[model samples]
Target: AVNLAIAFAMQGHENKVGLLDADLHGPCVPTMLGMQDQKLKVGPIGAFPALGPLGVKVVSMAFVLAGKEVPVVWRGPLKMRAIEQFLSEIAWGELDFLLIDLPPGTGDEPLSVLKLLPEMDGVIIVTIPSEVSQNVVGKAITFAKQLNVPVIGIVENMSGFVCPDCGKETHIFMKGGGKKIAQEYSVPFLGSIPLDPRVCEASDMGHPFIMEYSDSPASKAFMIIVKKIKAFISERQS
Candidate 1:
């Protein structure tokens, strides 16, 4: 989600973007974007999100927590209220796109987001090239459809691994699961992101892989996925 947000933000300044880290249980967006020490600036009107790379406004529970070690152990009502405040109270300010990073499940947080923001454009379900992960894709699509929300597409992450020395790509997790699942469920397969060690390293160091390693195979795949998403939105609008 952080990579996609930064990628879209990289499309020059005209397209403004905001990232809402709605994964209440695990708010990693701030840590991934190197905003661990930042906090939301609350004024009389509302709270202002922290400015991330390429001018992407960001809001996460990580920003309000006492520390990274602190846990958010709240009930459903509390969580719903917090998410509601995050949506309506934050001063996002003229966003061309607001991407909500949801937890991997059809749970309270995801349900709350969909229920609150009925106008959400769609959801891009990300899955790894594994049967277990692919199983979740169907559930996610059904969840969205049941809520009358559109399933934008599916993105396959860590699809392959390329040996740096030999330059040969290996399907470490098994090949073509993403495309196969997309076909099975009749949804668009955006692209496959090769497993790059640098992607993990960059994330740990609060850097977006696309910006840090644009020439890498994984980064190139991300660019392609972003373009496909824009195309999907364009087609819908037209």
Candidate 2:
């Protein structure tokens, strides 16, 4: 999701993007973006998101936590309130796209965000190429449909692993599950991102992999997915 946000921001022309880390239990977006220690600036109006790479505005609970080791152990109601504040209290300013990264599941965090943003463009479900992961995609699609939220599509991450030396692709988690499920549910298959070691390194260093390794297969896949997402949104608007 962080990579996708970066992809949209790095699209050359002036495109304003804001990423809300709605995954309350594990707000790793800040850490992955290399701003875990950064805090949101508050003024009389509201709080301002931290400026991330490629000028993407980012908001996450990790910024307000006492430390990296701190955990958000709150009930559902508390979490719902926090999300409400995140949406209403943050001065997101004007944005071309505001991507909310929800935790995996049809749980409270996603439910709250969906209810709050009834006019949301859509929800993009990310999954790995495994039966276990694909099974959850069905539930997610149903969840969005039940709530009257559009399912933008499905993104298959860690689809396959390419050996650095041999350049051979290995189906570590079994391939084509994403497209299969997308076909099963009649949703668009945005693209598949192959597993790359550099992605992990970039994440740890808080770098946007799509920018740093734009030529890599995974990065290329991200670009394709971003284009599809943009087209989807454009079509809906038209």
Give the number of the best model, judged by lDDT.
2
Highest-TM-score candidate: 2
lDDT of 1 at 57: 94
Write candidate 1's Cα lDDT for 1-238 as tens digits: 9999988887653338999999998998988888899999999999999998888899999988888899999988999999999999999899878999999988999999999988888999998898877778889999998999888899999898889899898888888888999999899999998899998899899998889999888888888888888888889889
lDDT of 2 by residue, 20-68 (tens): 9999888889878899889989999999999998789999998788887
Q: Would you give me the overall lDDT of model 1?
A: 0.89
Cα lDDT for residue 89, candidate 2: 98
What CA RMSD would candidate 1 show? 1.2
Candidate 1: where are CA atoms >4 Å away? 13-15
Tell me the deviation in Å of residue 75 in model 1: 2.1
Error of 1 at 69 (Å): 0.8
Query: lDDT score of model 2?
Result: 0.91
